[model samples]
Structures are given as structure tokens and as C-alpha cells.
Target: MARTRQPEVSNDVTRLITQIRAMIGKGEELPPERLLADQLKVKRHRLRLALETMRDAAELPRPIIRRNDSPVLKSDVVVQGTNALEVIELRIVLEPAIARLAAVRASPVQIAKILEAATTPQGVTRTIGDIAFHKLLADSSGNQLAASLYAFLRRVGSDHRLHVPTASAITSERIQQRDQEHRAIAEAIAARSPDAAEQAMRQHLRRVQREIADRLNPLETA
Candidate 1:
């Protein structure tokens, strides 16, 4: 199958991603960006790009933050049902455009419903209803076929826990960021600007993908 059009990283960066995948899989912390860059024989900029494009490594500078209370999310069930990479690939193809369409076509009721689904009420388990946001986006897009397909994807995601976000990614800072992103999406939809809505949605999805990588790698500052 053809590869997805993700970050325009060089082959060297791609190789570095694979190498880091191994290190992370083995429960190793990623080296500093400078050291990792040197080890990969790539420029620091290229290394950063690879890390950002690959996910969690971009946020390594923040801190690894081990929590006895909150376990990092890793969906072996979802991974068993289907490839993690494939789920991301599928989302990259379907979601941004669904957001775009929702912006242009969503009724006021649909918009309210979307915002409702995206926000969890106080005391609700954060992990539940993870698919509601994207699923609502598809349904609001005024495309029945797309909505049906997204429903199937939603089932796959919910059944396998693929839609759940990592525990750390829901930190106060990250929550603020998500709220801003969601606000941007809602504003764009209200304004009926497909372009902005699409962009905002894509950014949100990309961030989630990166968070997944971070959970897998759990790279700490070195």
C-alpha cells in the first residue's frame, strides 16, 4: 500500500523514527534532541521534525512525569483489532474533511450537540465516549454515507479502546489547549468557514496521534 502523506521528512528522519520506535518499545528514554540528532546523523531541525511528526518525542522536553495514580494509555486490544498506524491513517483521510463539511452544513442543533459530546461533564469518566466527537462531526457533515462509515469506525474504536486519549495528555495544560482548539473549531463552524474548521480539526487529530506516540515512548528529559 502507498504511504500516507504526513510530514515531509527526509529518509534519514524516517530511519530515525524507526530507531526511536525500537528504543521506546524497550522502555528506554529518548536521548536529548542534540544527542539524538548526533546519534541519528541528522540535523537537529530534521530530528525535531521527525520527532514532531512521529508524536510524543516532540513533547519530551516537558517531562516524562511518572504517575502512580494514572497509568499511561496503551491499547493492546485496539492494536489487536487493527494496526494503530492504520487507525491514524484512516482518521487523517476522513476526519479533517468531515470537519470541513460540518462547518459548512451543520445545523445549530448539531453544532450544540457536537460541543456537548466534545466536553465531558464533571465527574464523568474521561475515557468513556471518546468517539463521540469525531462521530458527531461526521454525522453533522450532511453526508449519510460518510456518517455511516464513521459510525463503523466509531464502533471499531470504541470496542477496542482506540479512541481513548492518554492520561497525561489530559493534564490541565493540555486540557486548556484542547478547549482552545475546540473553541476554534466551534467558532469556525459557526462562521461557516470550512477551511478554518478543517485546519483546526486536523491539528487536534495530529496532536492526539502525537500523544499516542508519547505514551508508547514515554521519553523523559535526559
Candidate 2:
């Protein structure tokens, strides 16, 4: 009698499950299926099977399914009364900690994403790249709850156009300066220097706050 081997798809799913466990912290929610599959370079169906197996084994949390009759909360409803300055204030307090954690916890792939997001591409809005950089740090922190909270903050900032600066403020010199600051933060994380990463993030946010304050009241800065 010949030995029976497990199916190739089953082996792939098992391998993905192991990779995912290594990639994320315990209790961290996996990224969306499509994104996770893309990131792992595995087929979506295989990822789904892996997720299902994990869920059955109590390794992953149960999905949150909403009833059709439940009221869906709108973004505006959830993020009321917040302005740009307030958002920056919250980010100043929150992001340095995220940077520190990213220094210690970020996987190699996450560090690559953080580095890639550090500078704005030609013709893209600087604010968008900045948001992506910060959010990548948050996600790389290995804390899913922290990542979710930071995502909410970013959504609030974007929905209200709170972070976009006026054309007059978007000078080439300022852009270059911001790029340097972003790289400093990213490099600190890559080097696994938690204190340096935290300090760099704090300095960057403080600079942004100063810019926003100057914009809102030019006289005070002058």
C-alpha cells in the first residue's frame, strides 16, 4: 500500500498560517483578506482557508457581522467637533509612542513599507504621504488596537481635510525639510533605536504643529 500525502493546497494553507503567526503579535487582528494575501504572496483562497482553520482552533477572533437593521455610524457622526489643531495635538501625544513600538516590533517587511512611505512622490500631496508614513508606523507597532485608533484619527483628519496645507506653504524648501525629518524617523526605526525614534517623531509632530499654528495666526509666529 502506498502512503497518502496531504493535498498541496492544505500544505500551502498550513504554511501561510505559520507565516501569519510569525508576522503578527498574539491577539492582533489580521489585515483584510485581500491585503493579507497580497502581502504574503499567496492566493486569496489559501489565505481564507488558513483563516478559517485558525478561527476554528480559536486562534483568531470571530468575525463581527452586522444585522441589516442596525444603524451604520457615519464618519462625520463619529468624528465631530475635531479640527486640524486638535488632531495634531492628539497625534503629538500618540505617535511618538507608536514610533517607539515600531522601533522594537516592526518586521522587516513593515520597516520597508515605512521607509517607502517616508517621502512624498512627485505630484502626490505631501500630506497624503505623511499620513501613510505615520499610519504605517502605527500598523507596524504590533498592536492592533493602537493601529485601529490611529486609523480613526487619520480618517478624521482626511475626511475634514484637516491636514492639507495651503499652496503658499508648500514650498520646495519646506518639502525637502519634511522629507529629511521623515527619513530620520524611519532610519531610527530601522536601527531599532526606540528612544531616537520617539524623539524624532516628537520633533516632527511639533514642527507640524508649529506650522499649523503659524498658518492659523501668522502674527504670533512673526
Most accurate candidate by TM-score: 2
Per-prediction tally of clashes:
0, 0
- Model 2 regions more than 4 Å off: 1-74, 161-169
Encode model 1's per-residue lDDT on 137-170: one tens digit a residue.
Answer: 7767877767766755555555544444454545
What CA root-mean-square deviation does each model show from the true structure?
A: 20.0, 8.0
| Model 1 residue 162 CA deviation in Å | 5.6
Off by over 4 Å in 1: 1-81, 161-170, 219-222
* Candidate 2 residue-wise lDDT, 71-94, digit = tens: 455557656766888888998989
Clash pairs, candidate 2, are none
Prediction 2 global C-alpha lDDT: 0.77
Query: What TM-score against the true fold does each predicted structure earn?
Result: 0.55, 0.67
The residue-level lDDT of candidate 2 at 221 comes to: 68
